[model samples]
Target chain A: MAICTGCSLLCEDIVASFENGSLKHAKNLCRKGHGHFQAAFTERTRPMIDGEQVTIDKAVERAAEILKSAKSPLLYGWSNCTEEAQSEGIALAEKLGATAEATIACTTSFCEGILMERVLSGKIETCTLDDVRNYADTSIFWGSDPSSSHPRHLSRFSYYPRGEKRQRSYEEERTCIAVDVRRSPTAQLCSNYYFRLPPGGDLPFMEAILAVLDGKIPKVADKKKMIELATVLKKTEWGAIFPGPGLIYSLQDKMELFEQLLARLNEITPFKVVPMVADCNARGFNELLFEKTGHASSVSFNGGSAAYGPEHSVLAAAKKCDAVLAIGSDPLSELPIGTARALAHQPIIAIDPRRSLTTDAAKVVIPSALIGLEAGGTAVRMDGVKIKFEPVMNSELLTDEQILARIMEAV
Target chain B: MVSAMEIYMLLPKTNCKKCGVATCMAFAVGLLGRQKKVDECTPLIEEKKYEAKLKKLREVMAPIEKASETGLIIHPEKCFGCGNCVVACPVNVAAEPTRTAVGLGPEGEKVILRVEDGVVVVNNLKECKRFGPSGTLCNACTATCPSKAIEFV
Candidate 1:
């Protein structure tokens, strides 16, 4: 069996067959996972230096030399890598991040960093995906569309299947509610239970729920539907809230309100929060970074002292740093265009198995083996479950850990 | 799924009992239930004036002709192998007692549907609820499919 690294769900029971560096046949894969499995055969990256083909050793040396000489270096993009690779990245960050102007950040700093701080600090309660499948009765998707993002979420964990306590399943026992800014595919499945919130209106929506729980009139346009939503919440045996980037960005510094809402719901019934994180091991990096440092992301180390703030974020670091090392992430296509322009101007060292915009424009590119299919390590699920995986096929390319460790030695 | 009313709209409304059914509506219903073939209606097939209606009706009911004995068609291209149908089907829930009900992939030969090669495939059509006289119009698999990949005709 193989685990798919396409998303944070980390679907474990994949039956795959590989021949001659390509996917021969696979079963139990979602559309995303199928594409991810097929990606290993397309657009394979090679070692390059300044757009010229080079040996792997030369590329590593150039990457190390560029970072060693930079006044401010930013080490970024560790979400798609394994926990072992991320640990090496952190060690490298500790070496260079201790420079007067160096910083370390990940893809989560853009959205999930602030919210992950709440989860890792015990401010919000989270559970394993297995527990959700076995016990959860009410699933509230707040600005999260698992159908388009995590395809197997509903069938494997959230709603569709019969659980230990929810043997009746979605027919009668399980109730799904979607709260989003627009009618997503998940919202359409919710039908009447979908509650549309305006952009940046998550706070008001939370207040309305609190009002209905307190038996007071809500300030929204529809009060009956609000009360009906409240009744669903009140009658929940065990509830889980799946927050996405929408809710995190909307709430921003006011994420304390979300914690208060969770606490209030727990007063009446049990509730858990699991942010719908993207990528394979984004939650893993956040948890590991949180374990080493109190803060999850956007931290800069100056003279061996770790400092945390927005000044150290990838967006801000893009302007501050003169060198970058992007592993397993494509910030050029993913970040704001302005940040991409800034990072594109700087000398970037990209380490990836696939060719992307970031790799296309990098000063140095060192290819690594694909994680789940070609190499194996542990990853954390979106719900904080640690799942260990093994490589399903053979590959001659080095893993991310070896590449990062070689660069650290060169530095 | 093509509806009875949809099939009824494409038939010849001449009310000519040449097909042995009392009314054209009953013939349309029989054609949908597979009790009467589309060629049984002589006016629609033989009469040149109603040739277009016969062609349109054939096009409409093409899915039913190719469907399994249970009148079910699962489009593999649209499926992501989430196993929603394997777990939602009542017959599968009773056959494969382990793994499928708690929301895991269904294994073994007792199951009616299994996800292979990243798509759901029919494993046992005989076990489907719509197979025999005891079969009812059970749509648990079609209704629960989020991708709308499973269809009943």
Candidate 2:
């Protein structure tokens, strides 16, 4: 049994088979997971320095030398690494007096506002996916398309299954509402209940919901639909709002509107918020960093003090830092083209299991065993639940934790 | 594998709204979903001119039931690669005690369905529990498919 690290869902029940140095068969894998598992065989990176094949020890020494000489070295891409590796990375950042941020810092301020402000502060009501399946009747996908993202979301927890309390399930008891910028696959599934918002329209749309909840006509287009949505919210026995990057990116700094909305909904009935985190262990990195430092992401341990703000963000750090260590994430592929170009100019130390743009451009490429497949470690689900798994395959490659520890030792 | 145009060709082509749908195309879609029957088309059934067409229509649609009884058919066009079917299978969870109850495959290395190119595909048909006579007729995937892309037939 293997856990899929393709996404933050961290789907635990995976049966994977390997034969002749290739993934022969795998069960319970989404397309993303399938791609991730297949990546082990295709484009597998070797220890390299300046496009030249090097031994692992030589690569580690080069990576350490690069970080050691740099005054403002940036430690990034912790979201895809194990919790153990993240902790080690944080310690390394502290020792090196470097700025550390995860890939989550590149987009979606969700970790900073929601995870740090509300969840860590205990200001918002939250529950696990299990609680959602068993009790949630109204599953609101706010600017989220779980169909394309967290694939098993509806079937396993949000809508489909007949839970202990939700015996009727999606047939009669459950109501799925999608609020998005366009008619996404999830919105199409919601059918009549879909609410199409304009780009950067989440704030006003949330205001409309709040207005309707207060028994007032919303100051937006389609007043009737807003009223109907309000009516549904009023009648909801148990509801959960799964906010994706769409909403988070839209709300940005004014995420308090979401908080106010959740507060208002909870006053009438039970409501919870579960962020639709992208990476498999993004939340784990945030939680671990939060445990060590107060901030969820974008923190710098420099001059014996933890400093956090936009200054420490990856986008900002990309310009200021001379050296970077990107582990388990490919910023070159996912980030904006300009940002990718900027990071490409820096001396990058990329540690990954598979080949990617970041690894391809790195000055030193150190291949590590994949977590949940070739290596076993702990990962936090999107909901902040800790899940541990054992590696499915035996590998000679070092785990991320071991690799990071070696780098730290060499530095 | 039958096209909507092929099903529409077998229709009376009368553009008759007696089937309660907008057009013959809509009726063809209904036929695919098993919501409307060929006999419901009064013109096709009563008119002798359409006798052979109706017979061919029935023959073409005959496999729907047997297919539903034997295996699950996933319409890739409707699928958005939502891992609903992958997670909803009991075989997936039962194969390993730690795994979730709803997911793709279990027992050995046979995968029933996999998402390819952002759409779901029946990668291994025989691996599904509903493939054989001793099949449990588990409709968890079909029941949970948000897009109704999966059908047991």
Candidate 3:
């Protein structure tokens, strides 16, 4: 079986057939994952410096040289790489006395890292998506639209599948509710269960739900709708809330209210909270950072000491650092225009398998092998499930682990 | 696609310089092209039929046409007394409020930060290192802005 690192699902059920060193067929791959797997054969980047192709060794050498000569270097983008590679990256950061951050800093600053860190440390109750598939009777998509992001979310895990306990399947056992600002694809699928709220209205909506749970009137223009939704929550046997970027971005400082609601819901019945991270290893990145230096996302190793705080985040550290080594992420396309331009002007080292806006302008580009397919290691699924895998194909390209290791060796 | 001449014939054609353009016809053309919004035409919506046409035209140009990969939408109604997006925008694409409008969502609702044009301007001007750049419409700055102003459309 092959693992698909296309998204945070980290689906371990992929089946691929290679013939004459080319892909023959692939099964159980979603359109997005299929694009990811197929990406191995197209738009592959070569080792380059100053927009000129160079040998892999030269690229690695140049990357090391840049980092070694830098005063404050920022090492970012490990969410798409393997755990082994991430370990090497941490070692490199420590050796170079640089700040080690991940794609989470950019995403979680507005999303769920703070909430997830607490949840992971046992501040709240949660479960794997597998548990949701088999056990959950109610699934609430708050500010998450998995229909567009994770196309196979419903059919493979949440709504459609008939798991060990859900013999009756989605026909009678499961209910999917969507709470979003707009009428999204998932909201349309949810039909009557959809709760459409205005922008930045998540806090008030949560309060209304809390009121309904408290057996009091909800403070909203549509109190009857709130009452009906509250009734659904009160009767849920097993429920799960999937918080996405929309909810996280809107309620930046109000995550405590969400935690309180979860606490309140637990009193009525069993409930769990699951965060929707963008990358496959967002959870893995958090867990690895936590286990290494007792930090979840941001950590600065300047002067050979690990100092961690929100200010050490990539968004916070990008401008402060003199040079940045972006691995497996395209910050130029993923950050705000100002932040993108700020980091772009620095001595940027982009390590990616394909061409991106960052690679186009990078001072050094060291192309690495794609994880989960060309390379093999472990990655944490979105729900904190640790999954291991082996490489499904062979190529001359070095894995991110090998490259980072080489850089560490050079340094 | 209403002609600029018909647009001029229908409304007061205030020829007000407030819309930036010299004539309401130019403003109408700008509005149709998303270069300008009907709300910019202070007098265009004063007449009942012109207002009805503006409302209908705004509906025809609902939110999806303006959606970028990041799924951010600008709320015109919610966006007032706040110029945070202008400062929060890294590429400075949204620096000019007059050119901004609701990207993808309801009519007369949700103002996009003009990141599309900003991306173009940044590239054209070759303004490097002003803010962090990403492959997608990154809301990192907006995410960190003290004002909770940026929203996904």
Question: What DockQ do you compute for every candidate structure?
Answer: 0.61, 0.23, 0.01
Indicate the worst ten consecutive residues by lDDT in candidate 1 chain B.
B96-105
The top-ranked prediction according to TM-score is: 1
Candidate 2, pairs of clashing residues:
B67-B153, B68-B152, B68-B153, B86-B103, B86-B104, B87-B102, B87-B103, B88-B102, B88-B103
CA lDDT of B86 in candidate 3?
Answer: 31
TM-score of chain A of 3: 0.95
CAPRI quality level assigned to candidate 2 from its DockQ score = incorrect
- Candidate 2 per-residue lDDT over residues A180-234, each given as its tens digit: 9888777866787999888889999988899999999899979998998999999
Q: What does DockQ come to for candidate 2?
A: 0.23
lDDT by residue for model 1 (A99-119), tens: 646787888898887888888
User: By descending TM-score, how would the candidates be arranged?
Assistant: 1, 2, 3
lDDT of 1: 0.86
Give candidate 1's total backbone clashes. 0
Docking class of 1: medium
For candidate 2, the per-residue lDDT at A139 reads 94
TM-scores for all candidates: the values are: 0.96, 0.81, 0.71
